[model samples]
Target: MQNTSHLLMIRPVKFSFNEQTAVNNAFQQNDTNNNVAEMAAREFDAFAQKLQANGVDVTIVEDTPEPYTPDSIFPNNWISFHEDGNIILYPMFAVNRRAERKPHVLKAIEKKFRIQNKIDLTALEANHQFLEGTGSMVLDRDHKIAYACLSPRTHMSALNNFAEKTGFTTVAFHANDRNGLPIYHTNVMMCVADQFVVVCMESITDENEKKLVRDAIHKTDKSIILISFHQMEHFAGNMLQVQNNRGEKLLIMSTQAYESLTADQIKILENYNRIIHSSLNTIETNGGGSARCMLAEVFLPVQQTQ
Candidate 1:
């Protein structure tokens, strides 16, 4: 399925601005407020509640305080659950971020879902090669395509390896921000939902690469919702589409992202699904991630319960 009704969220305990990730993640701001952790925890609870209110299944696990993973709230970077009963663990770019992949977290999930296989790519960290799960590639699950904006965190070798293992075709390109710095993660610049994609076209300066990406999206039979650099800055492109228990599609985004959209863009997107946005200013500002990053879609098969 392109969208999952179930999700996995990690409630942050030591939530703060991650210095290790800020090196390439231009979106992170140095949150000076001493109550940063408290504010982030509240924002996380609200976001999860918003999803639950919409009938989406959410399994939230508290981050272990023993190892400080400041960016642990954004679990999409380290793990992605597949419908084929596979749980793929990705190689993280930041050393601190690596600790976010916790075995107990998966054990918590296993109580509700069955894991048939494990695709462990963390070994690539030994080679200093990385592909940070869905953050590195915006997957078109329905079309079996992985759209990627190659950067320091997303490498060709890892993408190829993933494709070889998962039967996905990778459409890779280079994308940069206003100052010509590489976009840290593909999810920041583009989001592939069930029926439409929100993307920052201006970021893909290479005309040929832009066309290639558009053509690839067209092949997947998805409408491309173009977002400007300004909107992208507000996390507009960082959206995800998920289904509720009633099978209604809901487009999830941060309030910052929703407010940034033009009326026309909003109309176009609502044509496909209902918009569900909540305030995530604190999380987005300090975490360098938005709603999409906070959610790790769980497509695993449900465990049989007697």
Candidate 2:
């Protein structure tokens, strides 16, 4: 239940470095490449093509040029699709990111999927509290548990609201990078797969919270594949496990993230699912998000046709 064959991705129109997100997101860097937009678009197309070749149903949505939303490539942060016929819109911390949530995107998807209700949490942004969708919390759908790390972009108020509405229990923790700064997003520090969990245990500075997270994952019937802070820095923990059309499991990540994994770790992951990777240096450097962020899994039921 954690993986879905349908993925939603927004093609970048003005994919450039976002200064607002860079304030706390340590993963972002200044744009060094000249043709970043062209390079990122090519990378996005190639990534989507690779996923399609492997049997994943990808929905590509073209971003508008007039609004100039630089971080539009990471659509998973603003919205999430649920198997319970629900579409949740989250509160974004960055002002520009608010524009990334468009009604047309939902309308386009509603043609194929049956959405019963919409949960709009965007109003929380007025209170300066935010939870950037799946970026802030990693949900174990099968277990009905939500794992979240406290950060500027992730607030407990929004998290509690989500939990209350979705009937999901929360396991909150404080996580930091090697520099002792708060980890901007929970997905960047850990990922919950169907059969296994890829996480940087070193990121949790609190021993009690670390034990809590470990206990929760252990209780969920998943094998733990631990990565180091160094590997996490390279986005190794940002992987997502998804199923192809044939119901085969595929662990998806960027080439840089895949290369950062140790042989033992790779072997462990490969034991559960086939590894799929694509080159995303241009996107990673500027967007500060990799394979997982680009994908918003669609778990809603398909509308039956006559």
Residues 92-187, model 2: lDDT tens digits: 999999999877788889888899999999999999989999999999999899999999999999999999999999999999999999999999
Residue range 1-306, candidate 1, lDDT tens digits: 899899999999989999999999999999899999999999999999989999999999999997888999999999999999989999989999998888889999999999999999999999989999999999999989999999999999999999999999999999999999999999988999888888999999999999999999998888888998999999998999999999999999999999999999999998999999999999999989999999999999999989
Candidate 2, superposed: residue stretches over 4 Å from native: none
The global C-alpha lDDT for each of the candidates, from Candidate 1 onward, is: 0.94, 0.93
Which regions of candidate 1 deviate over 4 angstroms? none
lDDT at position 32, candidate 2: 78
Provide the TM-score for each candidate, comma-separated. Answer: 0.99, 0.99
Q: Tell me how candidate 2 scores on lDDT.
A: 0.93
Model 2, C-alpha of 114: deviation from truth (Å): 1.1
Q: After best superposition, candidate 2 residue 250: deviation in angstroms?
A: 0.5
Cα miss at 295, model 1 (Å)? 0.4
